[model samples]
Target: MDSVNSLLEGFGTAMSPLNLLWAAVGVLLGTAIGVLPGIGPAMAVALLLPVTYGLDPTGAFIMFAGIYYGGMFGGSTTSILLNTPGESAAVVAAIEGNPMARSGRGSQALAAAAIGHFTGGVVGTIALVALAPAVAALAVDIGAPDYFVIMLLAFIAVTSVLGSSRVRGFASLLIGLTIGLVGLDQMTGQQRLTFGSLQLSDGIDVVIVAVGLFAIGEALWVAAHLRRSSQKAIPVGRPWLGRGELRRSWKPWLRGPAIGFPFGAIPAGGAEIPTFLSYVTEKRLSKHPDEFGKGAIEGVAGPESAASASAAGTVGTMLTLGLPTTATAAVMLAAFQQYGIQPGPLLFERETELVWGLIASLFIGMVLLLVLNLPLAPVWAKLLRIPRPYLYAGILFFAAVGAYAIGGEAIDLVVLLVIGLIGLVMRRYGLPVLPAVIGVILGPSAELQLRRALQLSDGSLTGLVNTPFSITVYALIALILCWPLVRKLPLPARWRQRAGTSAR
Candidate 1:
């Protein structure tokens, strides 16, 4: 009941004409990027952060949320229209969306993504309202020791699941921590990694680092592989689903959220796991098994819905405990700090209006996104018709502006270039960039906690496992980190009983 009152106050602020306008603009920009290929919500938001520096905090956040959801919508558009998925999660949608497009059911594919996003948004927000507070309540029980343990678990969770490999993820996190530790130590006045550089004493800003990694790096990659090609997007024929289409889609829509929400709630969870799981679930359980891979509408409907819903689930874990489940979420968390806002534990109490307003605005944003995206999708797809040189040039320009805007310092630009080169090399080797970003952001925080935990135990290793809960969590982390290796090992004879691909 108290929560409801607070949320109503949030609505009061969110619906104000000024804030409302920001929300609309965010939706517009988000949709624009969503339609463009090789650009996504994460990069778009990072690029646009500089432009928002002078804006009011409330309006800035409203716009940022729009860009986030907008990117999700846009990625699906590229996947459906060109079989080139602009979003990682959209890969699942492409499996079915591309097939639908090939069969002249392009309109149906778009409709499914739109409807799925709307439903997923609503479901995720409701879950946010219900679950975020519960997590915070649990967090209140924590002592410094518990915090140290939780942070360790969070780091392990992110490294094990967020990246392709645990070692690389840890290395990325160490780099971030190293960067984070450069300035003055809060407890002691000592400078650990500054090497006597004056600028290093102030510490590197997360926003600057985020811009370099996601936007700068992505722009560089685009420039290197830019290609121009196009067929104008097929216009939506029916625009709205027919009775049969809805009947076929109902189960997938329902089932998708169930699968997606759980995956997104896990530590360092991303949309890929749930969408793939949902796709497989649908194919294996669908009554229309023969229809799959042959324009089964369910294929397009299930994964798209799951991907969006799971994205929402990431909000709960991220907001309450400072855990970032994906690259985009990590950037958004950085955005919160840029505004002097902290998202974990005390967030609901410290800035109730901002938190709940962001929640309610998601509902508003979802409606606007659906209306705006459905009609304008074809125009958005025509972005493929854009010249490659101009497109990448614009990307580079925005990347530069975004990098400079936050720091107003030139050396930051130099760092941006170096990181961009690193990003290009990582991309070439199929190494995931997200874990690196996570590692960088969480590394120092984890380090401080590790030191604290060791001090609590008087540097005794056995003291680390004093708590059964802490021991259990560490074991879980060990198992998860070992998952890839486990998959490659031979299966026991008793377990090799059945064989069939899960239709998804």
Candidate 2:
């Protein structure tokens, strides 16, 4: 009841004219940027971070919430119309959505995607409203040791789960931690990695790192692999569902959120897994399984809903635990830091209006997305027709501007280019970028918690595992790290015999 009352108050705050306008602008910008090839929500938020520097924290976050959801919607648009997924989460959509487009059911695919996105986003947000407060209540009791262990788990999870090679992912994380280590030590007042430069003492701004890695790096990469030819996007009419199409979609829409939210709320469980799972689940249950590869409404609906729900789940985790499960959430976490606001257990108590308002804005954003996008999806599709060279040039320009705006220093540009190069190299080597960004953002905080835990225990290493929570989390981390080796172990004779019997 308290949560409900707080949410109603939040709706009041979010529905104010100014905040509503910001939400609208954010949705429009997010969709526009998301429709472009290779630009996902993370880059969109990073590139647009500079725009929010002037706004108050509440308004900025409201806009970010809109942008986050809008990006998911726009990615589906491209996946359906062009068979080009704007981000990895949308890849499943293209498998069936593009086929639907080719087969003259483009409007139906778009409608299913839009409605599914709405359904998943709303359900997930409601779950966040219910779960975040409870989680935050529990999180308030977490000691520094437990927090440190959790961060460690996050580090391991991202590296182990994201990419094909754990080695490359850890390598990327190391690079980010190295960048994070540049600042003066808070406890000892010592300059660890400043390299004798006063500018380095304050450390590299996360904004520069995020923008350089996502925006500038992406531009340079696209420039290198620039294709002279372009494919035309399939024409989509206004997105609307017939009664039959709606009936086919309703169940998948509900099921998608159930699969997505849990995966998204946990550490290292990204949208890719849940969206893929939703796709596979829908395929198995769908009545028209034969139409799957060719153009099944269930395929489009399930994955799209899962993607949106996963995004909301990511946000809930970010708000409650100060942990980010996805790239876009990481960038938004940085945005929170930029406002001198840390997201965690105390945040709801300290920033009640801000928290609730942000939550309410998500609901509002969903409605606006459906109302505007259902009619304007055709216009959004035309965005793909824009030439790549021009789009990338604009990205480069904004990247430089956003980087310089961080501190208004010429040296920032140099740092930006250097990081951009590193980003390009990482991409070339197929290193996943999420772990690196997570490392950069979480490294300092983890360091703080570790020192605090140690200080309290007088430097006894056992202090790290003194608590039940810490012990359990560390055990989980060990299981994650050793699971690959566990898999390589030979099966017991009985199990092997059973497996052979099953095969026979």
Candidate 3:
């Protein structure tokens, strides 16, 4: 009842004329950023951080919320229309969406993605409203051991469950871990892999790594494979889903949020794992399983919905626990700090109005994104018609610029180039890029939690599994790691003999 009243009060605030206009502007800018390669919600928000300096906190946050959802909607547009994913989460969407675009079903693919996002976003927001306070209250009981275990689960899931080969996924994760080690150790105050450079003290920025791997690396590889004849884009009509397609999508759309929200709520959560998991689930359940790698609409629907729901869950975690799970959420955390707002259980008590307003704005943003994206999807598809040379050139330009913009340092550009080269090599060798990105992002945090746990236990390793929750999490990780080997085991001779006897 209290939640209901607060939400109603929030709607009153969010519906004001001034806030609505800000929401519209944010949605527009976020969509543009999403359509462009290399620019994600984090970069868009980071770039616009200065513009919000003078605005009131409520208004600024409302706009930021819009950008978050808008970027998600726009990412699907690029994935479907151009076979380019503006964010890592959208990579799953591109697997089927791009093929659909080539088959002249681009409009259908776009519609599925938009509707999926809307379904997931709306559901996720409701979960946030109901679960955030309780989760925040429980978070106080979570110690470093719990956090370390959760991080381990995330790491294992990404590396083991994502690509075709576990070897390649592990290799990618190792590379990301190595990159993550390139700074001063948080505990010892000693440099581990800096190689005596001043700029290396702070560690490589996540924004630069993301842009280099996804944007610049992709551009260079495409450029290398450029052919003499220009490729033509398939023409797309107005976006609409047939009754059959709609029937196929509804279940996955519902299921995606269920899988995505919990992952996003966790401290180590990121959208990549949830989206991939959703894709695998949809593939397993789909009647047309053979169409998965070709142009299955379920692939696009499930993953896009998961991505949006994960984003919403991330928002709730950020507000309730002050946890920043994804790169974009990290940027928003910084925004909160800029305004001297510390998010946590106390934040709700202290800043009730602002918190509810932000939550309400998220609901508002989802609707605006659906309205904006469904109508403009065809216009977005036209982006595919741009010449290859120009498109690749633009991607590289934005990648470099986004990297440099992370900090005003020239060395950032050098790092971008090196990582871009690595990305190209990974692409050439058929290695999945997402595991590496996840490794780099989560490795440092995991290390911190482990160290904190050890410190608390006076260097006793037993403390790592002190609680029932921590023990369960570790057991889950062990099961995930051993499942593949378990499947490979041969039946015992006695069991085989019994089966043969029964057959005889």
Candidate 4:
């Protein structure tokens, strides 16, 4: 009941006229930028962070919610019309959505995607509302050892599970940790990696890192590949779905959320998996399975809904645990840090209104996206025709501006360029960037927790596994690290029984 009252109060705050306008502006800009190829929600948020420096925290976050939801919807528009996914999360949607466009059913595909996003987002927000407080409550009892273990699990999951090569991922994480080591040590007030430079004492800002890696690096890479790509926008009519079509979509909408939220809640960096799973499930259960490759509506509906729901779940996880599982969530965490706010169990107890209001804005953003995206998809599709040189050049411009805006230090610009070059190399080598981002953000916290645990145990290593939770988390991390070898092992003969009726 207390949660209910707090939520209502949140609705009251979010419904204010100023906040609503911010939401509208965010969704509009997000959709416009998101429609362009190679731009996802994380890059969009990183590019916009500089402009939000002057706004109050509540308003800034409310607008972020709108942008987040709008980006998800806008990705669908591009995927269906141009056969180009804005990010990995939208890859499954392009498998069928583009085919539907070629078959002249683009309108139905757009309608299913829009409505499915609405359903999953709404349901996921409700789950967050009901579950976040409980999770925060439970988190209050965790000790330093448990926190360290959890961070280890996050490191293992991200580095080992995300990209094609664990070696590249671990190498990227080490680079981030090295960057993180440049600042003054929190305990001894001693410099570790700073080479006697005054600017190095304050540590490299996350905003600079994000903008350099995501915006500048992506722009450079896209420019290299730009000339070889040709894309045409498909026309979308009124996105009208008949009652029969709506009936076919409703169940997948519900199921997609169910499949997506848990994956997002866990700090495993598996955001792309749920969409693929949802797509496969929909195809197998769909009555018209043959229609899948030819542009089935369920194919569009299920995966898109799963992607949105997964995003919502990520919001809840970040709010409750201060753990960011995706790149976008990592940027949001950096935004929280910019305001001198630390997100964790204490956050709910201290900043009740701010947290709840952000949650409420998510609900509002979903409704607004449904209204805007369904009709305006064709309009958004026009963004794909933007010339590659202009689009990428603008990205570079913003990246420089964003890096320069942080503390007005000329050294920051140099660091940005250096990191941008590294980012390009990583992208060329297919190294996943999320683990490195997470490592930089969490390394300091992990070190703090480790020291506390050691102090409590008089430097005894056994203290690290003093609790069952810590042990379980460590076990999970070990399993994640060793799973590749396990997969290579052949099954025993007794366990390899064929699936067939008994001959008796």
Q: For model 3, where is the 10-residue window of minimal lDDT?
A: 495-504
Candidate 1, superposed: residue stretches over 4 Å from native: 228-238, 452-472, 484-504
Misplaced by over 4 Å in model 4 are 488-504
Clashes of 2: 0
For model 3, the superposed segments whose C-alpha errors exceed 4 Å read 5-26, 29-68, 71-113, 227-231, 240-307, 310-358, 488-504
Q: What TM value does model 1 have? A: 0.90
What digit string (tens of lDDT, one per residue) describes model 2 on residues 1-504? 888999999999999999999899888887887788868889989987887678898899898889889998998898889887787777788888988999999999999999999999999999999999999998888889988998898899999866678899999999999999998987887997988999999999999999999988899988999878888888878888899999999999999999888888887556777887898899899999998789999998998899889888999999998999889999999999999898988898999999999999999999999998899999999999888888999999989889888878899999999999999999999988888999999999999999999999999999899999899989999998998787842322332342233222
The lDDT, on a scale of 0 to 1, for candidate 3 is 0.78
lDDT of 1 by residue, 124-217 (tens): 7777777887788777555445555666776677666654456777766665666667688866778878889887787777767777777677
TM-score of each: 0.90, 0.95, 0.73, 0.94
Better of 1 and 2 by lDDT: 2
* Candidate 3 residue-wise lDDT, 1-504, digit = tens: 788888888888888998888888888877777776546787566555544457888888888888888888888887776565766667777788888988888889989999999999999999999988677667657788887887677668666755557799789889988998998997898997888988887888766776677677777887787666644445667789999999999999999999888877763336767777788899999999999868999998998998889988989978876656666776676567558786666777788888888888888888888897888777765655566677677777766666666567788888988998999999999787766776776688789999999999999999899999899988888887897788842322332342233222
Better of 2 and 3 by lDDT: 2
Instruction: Give the better candidate number (2 or 4) by lDDT.
Output: 2
